[model samples]
Structures are given as C-alpha cells and as structure tokens.
Target chain A: MSAEGDEAIQRLIALMARLPGLGPRSARRAVLQLVKKKGALLLPLAEAMREVAETARECVNCGNIATRDLCEICADPKRRTGQICVVEDVADLWAMERAQVFRGRYHVLGGTLSALDAVGPEELRIPRLVERVREEEASEIILALAATIDGQTTAHYIADQLPGTSVTSLAQGVPVGGELDYLDDGTITAALKARRAL
Target chain B: MSAEGDEAIQRLIALMARLPGLGPRSARRAVLQLVKKKGALLLPLAEAMREVAETARECVNCGNIATRDLCEICADPKRRTGQICVVEDVADLWAMERAQVFRGRYHVLGGTLSALDAVGPEELRIPRLVERVREEEASEIILALAATIDGQTTAHYIADQLPGTSVTSLAQGVPVGGELDYLDDGTITAALKARRAL
Candidate 1:
C-alpha cells in the first residue's frame, strides 16, 4: 500500500479500536474483512453510520435516542401507563425493553450521581425526571438501577424528590438460572433473608 | 427510541455483526456505544469508512490493496530486491508488514487451492505470480502460507511452476513464546524433526 493508503487504514484501525469490544488486533482483522466484503459489509455499515449520525438524537422528554424531539416510547400514547422506569443510561432502557415486560415510559439519567467525579443532579437528567414525574402525573416510579453505592444513592435522592408518587426498586436476590455456588455471600444472605413461599 | 431510530440502530447492529470476530450480542453493544459517543466515535468512524471505501483498491500487479494501480511495496524502487514473498491473502501481507521484517515485495494469492471447494491454480493468482517472477527476474520466492494440507499443496504447485527460481517456505515449528506443553503432537513432532543447532 502507498503511504496515503496505509495512513487511511491506520486511521480507520485507530478509530475502530476505540469501540466498546474491539481492540487494535481485532480491529485490523475487521478492517480486512470489511475490505474483502466491501459491498456486503463495509459499504452498508458506512451508510448506516452516516444515517444514524445525521438522524439520531436525544429525546427531550426522556433522554432516550430518537430521530426527533421525542423518542418512540415517549411518543407512544399507549406507553404512558402512569408508571415510569428510571435507569442510569440508554443501554439500561434498551435492556428493559428487550425483556418485553415493561409497558410504561422511561427516564434515562445518563449516569448516577458521583461525588468523587463532582457529578450532580444537574449533570444527569435528574431535574428532567422530576419534572416528568409531576407533569405526566406518574403514579409509580421503578428504580431499575445497578446494585452499586452510586446507584442506591441516586435512587434515594429521586425517591426523596417525589413525595406524592410511590417509588419502588427491583428485587435484589440470586439471579434466575444462577447456581447457588456461583453467587456471592451478600447475594446468598439477601436471598435467604428475603425467602418467600415458592 | 422511536420506530425510525430503532430501525436505523437495528440495521447498524446487523451490519456490524457481519464483521469478523463480532457476534449479534457484541454488535448490539458496539452500536449502542457508537450512538452514545456519536461526536467522538460514530461520526469520525463513518467518515473514515467512507474515505477508505472510496479510495482503497487492489494493486493490479500483485493483488494487494492500495489506493492506486500498484501498492506501496510494489511501487517502491528499493523493494525490487529480486525476491517476492507469496502469501495467501492481503491480511497475511499486512501481517508481514506489521512484523517490520521482510523488505521484499509480496504477491497476494487471494486464497489457497482447495480440492473440496473446487479451487485450483486458475482461481488464484498463480499465473500472475509466474509472470511476475519471470518479468521481475526474481531469484527466490518465499511461501508464507498456512500449515494446512491445502496450503502445502498450493505451495508445491507454485514451486513446480518456477523451476529456475529457488523456492522456500516459512518454518513450521513451535510459535514464538509458545509453551511445549500447549503444542499439539504434530507440531512437537515437526519441531523435533526439523531441529537444528542454535
């Protein structure tokens, strides 16, 4: 390859390496495969990226991504079930959707409050979530956050803000299909303490 | 997300899954990350993909990818060292370049001969390689193919085509930093058979 071509490929590899799962070595292999299957994989991916880049936007109501001011879930009148699921990020919102159980709206906080990083409610969408809860007249708010300190702190803060609305959290116990031997001591204790009739 | 946004993201994920080393699950994660960091990763990657898609091409002389008629290694006047390294694909050529050794030009065969797949010399760049050897007055040809049955058969076939030039192959032995305990029986036997004094 010419110097220019090498530079272009190198630039591409560098960019691909920044992706979530791919590293430099795998990125190179991906680029090679893309080049080999130019019409099938590379060109289509490029077009998709361009399209998404031009159209994808954050929803003004929920912080979920959409091609318009409001995301699909927010726009759907049927989804407004007077229940809002609060999550840390859009990925979490997508995960909830994948479960196909949640029929209500969502509020993506972008991230949890981190005092060490100087992140506050202003940095996240906490204020927006509070405003939505009141304006939308939500009856209940489900905090589907991670089992981390920051996640718990954010959940408590949101609960404190919504005095009239009922706020609950997802159950914490052994994961379904998980083996007892694989679970940690804390999870075992929690599961034993929360034991109920099966 | 809205229906349109979901469609675009789903399309991007499907395309990303087609790349080597990426599966449907990982592709979904990657697409989410790309959307989340649009300005930092997604847009720039789209631009790079477009640039490479428009400029990258194959070297007519050696079957290597380049932005021009001839690849950089073939175009370099100093690389005409009367030795051409024949490889199975452009990935191998790039790997050799990454090693920063082997200063000679290369001939990418696209693929090796496969009896089961109905592939033969005509399907590869065998005839082109013969012409290159004669035209360039090459004194040696190094076969850096995989240590597979089909790869060996292709190497022998190429060697038979050029009687005057001295043909060699990459050493088949334990890989660098590879433990003897982890090597297969065949590799250990080959290494023992080809043992030499240090």
Candidate 2:
C-alpha cells in the first residue's frame, strides 16, 4: 500500500466515527470487518445506504420520515381515528410505533420550545399542527413528548395554541415491572399521585 | 414510508447491527442519525464504503490490509530492519503501528493455533511467516500475540520451525497505570517474577 491507501482508510474511519454511537477505535474494528467480509457485509451495506440516500425523505403532511410524499401512517385512512399523537422527533414516533399502540396519526414537532436556544413555535411546526386539528376535526391530541422541562413547556405551548381541543399526556409513574426500591423520588411520587383504583 | 422504504431502512439497520460494537437498538439510532444527516454523514459514508470495498485488500506478503499486493510497511525499504513482529490479527498490527515504537516489519498470522476451533498452521499465515524469516534473513521474530494458551502454543511451534532465528514474546505483567490492589492474581505473579532493577 501507498500513502493513498492509508489516507483512504483514515477517511473511512473518520466518517464512521461521526456515527451516533461509534468512536475511533470501534470504527477501526468495524472498517476491518467490512474489509474482511466484503461480499457478505460491505457491498450490501453500501448498496442499502446508497438506496436510502436516494429515496428517504420526511413526510410533508406529518413530518415523519418516508420515501414518498406521505408516510405509511398518513397514507392509511384506517389509522385516522380523529386523534393526533404529537412527538418531539421521528425517532420518538418510531418508538411509539414499536409499542404497537397509538391507533392515530402523528405530528413530529422536530424539536421543543427552548428559550436558551431561541427555538420557538414556528421552528416546531406548531402552526401546522393547529391547522391539522382544525381541518381534520381531531377529537384528542396525545402529547407523547419527553418528561423533561423543555418537553413539558413545548406540550403546554401546543395545548395553549389549540384551545378547546382535548389534549392529554402520557401517564407519569413507576414503569411496569420496575422495582420500588430502585424507583426515583419523582417517579415514586408521580406513581403514588396517579395511582389507579386497581 | 412505503413498504419498500421501510424494508430498505430495516436492511440498513440489520447491516449496522452486524458491526463490531453496534446492536439492534444502537443500530436503529445510527440509522436514524444517518437518515437525518444525509448530506453531512450518510452520503459521505456511502461513498467511503464504496471506495474501501473497491480498494481494500489483504497484503499477499504479510496479510495486513492494504490497497496493493504489498502493505506500506512491507513496501518501505526503511522498515526492513531484520526484525519481523508477529501479531494475531490486522487489528493488532494497527495497534502496534499507532504506538510508533516498532521500526521493523510485521507478519500478521490471522489467528492462533486453536484445537477447539480446529485452526491449524495452514489456516493462519504460519507457513508464510517461516518462509519469510528465511528469505528476508530476519534477525529477530517478536511474538506480540495474546497471552493465551493457544497463542503460546503457536509461538513455540513457530520458534521450533525456525531453528536459528531469535524468537521473543512480549513481556507480561501489570499493565501501565494499573493499580496493584486491582491487578489480577496471574498478572501480580508475572509482575513479581519479572521484577527488575528500576
């Protein structure tokens, strides 16, 4: 190998390191595996990434990722139960989808309202969500945002924007199967406050 | 997304999960990030993978990854110092290179002699190593293999094959910055046994 070969491998490693979880060392190991198993892993991965690069786009209606103008959920008429589940990002929407619950459509907020970052309603597609609720005549709006301060603030802002709409949030409590001893104070308090008549 | 789009994303996640440190959940996160940052990360990664897939190959001489028949170290005239360091894998070779300590060349054995896995001398590059030592007139053969039983057996076998060459193993003991209280029993014993004038 020449200097060019070394440069090529370094370039690949640098790119791999920028991935969500990978670092320089792990990237090296991954690159080595990719090189060693060219036919079995490398070529197929390259093709998949290329195909996704060519096709993947966010759904214009819901802001969820899709290959077409509308995502599968938005396209399916059966999913429109006159309810809209709002989330901070597409990843959150996917997490909700994985539970096999939520029989309604979604509105990906893209992000939360943050005074520190100057992120406001316009940046989060709040206007579009309000319009959708009015046009679709949605019965309920489930706020599936995170339990963080920013998440709560965003949810409240959205709720205020859509006055008269029945907006609810995910129940805050101790997780199912979670041990009482390991539960945080906030969770324990919330769970006790929201205790059901079971 | 359409069914085809979903399937394409799934394929990418599966391939990512096969990488060294990434699992299904992390793979999903990585894939989502890639999709989100298409121009910044995904397209460049796809191009890099394609380039590596086309150029990356094992050096015929030393078994290290390279773009050409001979690796950079083997191709360099300055590195032929009559000492050939032996390592179990290309990753180990890369580690040694990163240290920038060794001035000699290398011979990557691919793996150690493992009876459990039915690995033998031919499966590794042991035969090539012996022939190289003779042809290159090597003065020393440094075994930088792991301190495992299989690694020791492979090193001894190689030493026996080359009667006249000076074969040495990496010094084993407490690792640098390792605490004495936390050191393993075997390491403490090795460290005590190999105690020298400091």
Deviating ranges (above 4 Å) for candidate 1:
A1-5, A172-198, B1-5, B172-198
Global CA lDDT computed for model 2: 0.78
Cα lDDT tens digits, model 1, A31-134, are 98888878888889999999999999899998988888988898888885688888887766765675555688889888889999898999999989888888
TM-score of chain B for predicted candidate 1: 0.84
lDDT of 1 by residue, B1-198 (tens): 432247888899889988877887678778878998899999999999988899889899999888788888888898856888888887667656654457788999999899999998998989999999999899888876766777879989998999978887766574753432234546644543443321
Each prediction's whole-model lDDT (CA):
0.77, 0.78
lDDT of 2 by residue, A1-198 (tens): 322237678898889999878987788888888998999999999999999999999988889878789888898888865789888887667666654555789999898899999999999889999999999999888886666678879878888888888887765563543322233445544543443311
True-structure lDDT of candidate 1? 0.77
Considering every candidate listed, which one attains the maximal DockQ?
1
TM-score of each model, paired residue for residue: 0.86, 0.87
Real A-B contacts recovered, model 2: 0.66
True contacts kept of 1: 0.63
> Could you tell me which residue pairs clash in candidate 2?
A72-B1
